[model samples]
Each structure stands twice: as structure tokens, then as C-alpha cells.
Target: MPNAIQDQEIAMLRSELEMLMKEREALLRVAGYAAGFIAELDSFDVPRGAMQAAELLAECVNGLTEETLQDALSAVQAHSVA
Candidate 1:
């Protein structure tokens, strides 16, 4: 009975891990697109009122690790073609 309970717990944990992974991928895709869009924005064109918000977004994206940023950018590029 104890072994069975442990097995059930492990299964639940695995399921949760899988769900988290999928959610991470979705988040990475969004981050990638946002980074790309921000890159194309001209500072002059951004409204003064929105400058702070835009800076915050850029700062958040820049805060990602290089590997994570690469993964995020790749995620969007991969789906863009289809």
C-alpha cells in the first residue's frame, strides 16, 4: 500500500512537471515575439507617455539569461514560418 501511494505521488508530480514545461514554452514564445517587436521600435516613434512601459518590457526581456533568451527567440522563429 505504501509503495502504491508513492507511485501515485510520483505520477502526479510528473504530470505537473509536464504541464509546467508546456506553460514555459508558451511564455517563451510570447517573450520572443515581444523582444522582436521591441527591437524594431524606433525610440523617436515611441510616445513619451509609453516610454516607461516600453523600457520596463525591454528590461524584463534583457534580464533573461542568454540561453533562455536564445530559446525564447528560437521558439518564435520556429513557429513564424508555419
Candidate 2:
């Protein structure tokens, strides 16, 4: 009986993990787009009030793991219009 309960819990956890993975992929795509946009933006044109936020976004994107950052940029490039 205990083994059956454990099996059911394990299955539930696996399902949750799959959902989280999908969500992570979606978030990565968003972050990739943000990074691309920030890269193309001119700091001088940004309002003083918004400059701090823009810098924060860039810093966060830069903090991503090297492999993850590559994946993000690849995702952006794949979807970007030429």
C-alpha cells in the first residue's frame, strides 16, 4: 500500500516537473526577446527614469548561465525577422 502511494506521488511530481519545464521555456523566450531589444536600444535615448530599469534588465540577462544564455539568444534569432 505504501509503495502504491509513493508511486502515485512520484507520477504527480513528474507531471508537475513537465509543466514547469514548459513554463521555463516560455520564460526563456521572453527573456531572449528582452535581451535582444536591450542590445539594440540606445542608452542616450532612454528617459532618465527608465534607464535604471533598462540597465537592470540587461544585468539580469547577463546573469543567466552561459549555456542558457546561448539557448535564449538562439531562440530569439530563430524567431526574429530578417
Candidate 3:
């Protein structure tokens, strides 16, 4: 029984790790896209501070969940379009 419980726990942890990896990739993709956009801009302007936000976002991936990451991605997309 103890071994079964341990196995279940290991499986749950593995799932969480996989989710974290996916989240990290998504956040990194966001960062890369933001960086590419920044690179194409003619010059730094008032909104140039968005680069810093992207950097922070890249580092915040591990702590976020699927729903939260989705909401964040939507917000980022909206903001970028504006």
C-alpha cells in the first residue's frame, strides 16, 4: 500500500513537472516574440518599458497554472495590439 501511494505521488509530481515545462515554453515564446518586435522598432519610446515586462514574464513561468497562463497570454496579446 505504501509503495502504491508513493507511485501515485510520483506520477502526480511528474504531471506537475510536465505542466511547468509547458508553461515555461509558452512564456519563453512570449518573450521571444516581444523581443523580436522590439528589435524591429525604429527607436525606444514611452512603451519601450514593455521589454522589461517580457523579461519578468519569462522568469515567472514556473509558478503559473494553465488557466492563469492562458489569461496572461490573452492580456498580452490584447496589449500588444493596442
Q: Clash number for every model?
A: 0, 0, 0
Question: lDDT score of model 2?
Answer: 0.89
Write model 3 residue lDDT over 1-82, tens digit each, in one string. Answer: 9999999999999999999988866765574454455446554562667767645645566356667656656756765687
> What lDDT does the true structure give each of the candidates?
0.95, 0.89, 0.65
Backbone clashes in model 1, listed as residue pairs: none
Candidates in order: C-alpha RMSD to true structure: 1.1, 2.5, 9.4
Clashes of 2: 0
User: In candidate 2, which residue pairs get closer than 3 Å at backbone N, Cα or C atoms, i.e. clash?
Assistant: none
For model 3, the run of ten residues with the poorest summed lDDT: 37-46
For all predicted structures, in order, the TM-scores are 0.92, 0.80, 0.54
Per-residue lDDT of candidate 2, residues 1-82 (tens digit) = 9999999999999999999998877887888998888989999999999999999999999899999988888877776754
* Model 2 alpha-carbon drift over 4 Å, by segment: 78-82
> Which runs of model 1 end up more than 4 angstroms from their true locations?
none
